[model samples]
Target: MNLNFITSQISSICSSVWNCIISLDPKVISTIVSIIALAITALTLYANTKNNKKNNFDNLFFHLISLLNKIIISSENNSEKVEITLNDIKKQNKAQLETLKSQKIKEYYEQHKLAVNSRFVELENMYLKIESKKLEKIKKSNNTTDTAVPIRKSEFLSPIDDLDEINTSDRSQVYYSYYQNNTTDEALNYPFDVSDNGIETLLRMTSFKSNPSLAIYNIFNSDGGISQFKANINVLKSEYPQNETIDKINIELSELFLHKNMNIPSEISEDMKKDIVNDILLDNKHGSYFRTVHRILKIILDFSKSEAVLNKYCGILRTQLSERHLIILFYNAQYTDRGKKFKNLVAKMNLWGDNSELDVGANSDAIHFATNNLIWKDKDLKILKEEYVRK
Candidate 1:
């Protein structure tokens, strides 16, 4: 067939159909046109809505996966960070699902829930492995048998000789730069102007209140003072039976004597230092020992006029006590009014440090201890000690 003939035939059929429709009532034609337009518009709107919903679901799904992956990647030995990331996922999951309004999206949410739960399991496993390694490191460090010469009971309990005649106003400054100057091997001989009774009195006074006259304070604040304090405490620990009250008193006295900015001895291998830091961060029972001590120290600091004195005490407490001893001491004070005050102080102190600071002195470990300490309490500490320390 010729092209022209086909075109003319098609045009004639369309003209005939148009004439028939035109010949009908004008009102009927208008109504029919309106119905056709409405149907076309509705179909277009439905297709667009479907496409938009699909895109939204895809975005949500990808976002969920990305967030979870980030959380997994960022989770190292840090339980605190992992917990925070997990909480973010929880919040985002709800918000993401709320914006979606489709059966498909709801199904995706169900699947996402399973995936997230699985990721959390992975995170928990990671935390446990980190914790196990840290505990092992501490166990090795504390495994040494108590082999020092036994302290005589009379030595600790003896009355201060010449207490009435001793010049209290002219207390000599005993320098104890043990760790600061790397003097770990030097005998920690304090100037014996005060007798054993005097030392005991000072220790007792430290347990109850701050006493600047305590010659031990000078020892604790000095460089390498931590080692000296540790040596002294170990002596006491050996002499006395494992009385919780005695342990508590020793810890309190140690806190009063140590410096706040004291560093771990350089002789300690980098690996050991790393282990200590990890333990401090992850091991709830033993690691948290300093936290409870810090809480008590905060109360003391609140009323203390000398920052130098308080920091030294904190330093000694942080450095000298074993993880086991710290846990016991923390429990002893956990129920006291001062313990509650310490908890509140830790929360407030956590927000004070800057991550970019290079000087370890400038970024005090006290703040970190305070921040992490708030995470667990007496019950948690007890469980951790029973599970990790006792074993």
Candidate 2:
């Protein structure tokens, strides 16, 4: 196996074999031939198998790379496709709402009007006949027994009229905000600094602190203190005023923000923004995208024999991904259980690298895979291997 041993044996054998070449020593020549053949075989055995295995491993590595490439490509395409699909869905939703507001309500109002008019006509004709009978009776009885029925005053009110009076401008504005502002271009954000968990935690502060007035101070004391809490509420009230939503989120910040003594009411989901976002995030494409990236990373990570190897493969994968693809990956991993496993793998591998897209503000735009574009700020998906992902 040693190069020196192989070369020395060949050299010594060849030097002796020169005597067989000169003096025509047949036995020495035969022995020399055997020795030469054995040395060559030893050298071949040392080199070929290891090289073959290296080639095979490289082949498999590249194959995984190819699959990763496809996943990234597909994710971008899928995220864009999700955008178109969500727009169509929004338009369909708006159309259905418009139909309910205009067509359905109008049809009901018209049907009620026709039925009421017919009933009124029937009642009038019956009254005329009854009057004739009463007159005959009165004439017959010499007008001795006569009674009068006073008219009841009433007015018809159309359902459409009431709707127009109450919700016309509100409905139009809601439709505009819900459909238009929810688009990928605008970034589909839930209003204010109130996060999904923030809403819940703030609402549940009462359970933590019995005294309502100093509830925020006591509850969020561990988290950056009351100043941070007040700043959060201030941002919430300033950025998203309660009046922006037609159906109004019932968590009155004035009660909690200004009046520190008052209890935090609850999460602000009544406005339907959260529900609308929840609906879009339920797309199957999101799950499928997660699985692909998860599996890709799994294979790479499982195959990796060392930390260096893991970083090498992960770095390669990271280089291959576009910002949109990373956005989709981050979105899936942010929410689901399957994504938890995927996220753990990502953290383990440090796939995003030091200057991750998140670090570089690549997430400033709308995330494509979040059901049209679940708008999150640049900091929303910031995850580092050294630090866990932040909301």
Each prediction's RMSD to truth: 29.4, 23.1
**Per-residue lDDT of 82-110 in model 2, one digit per residue for the tens?**
55544543564455454444443334335
Q: How do the residues 230-297 of candidate 1 rate in per-residue lDDT, one tens digit apiece?
A: 55455445544563544554565455334343222213333432343343334333224334345445
Report the error of model 2 at residue 88, Å: 12
State the weakest 10-residue window (summed lDDT) of model 1: 175-184
Model number with the top TM-score:
2
Q: Which candidate has the top score in lDDT?
A: 2
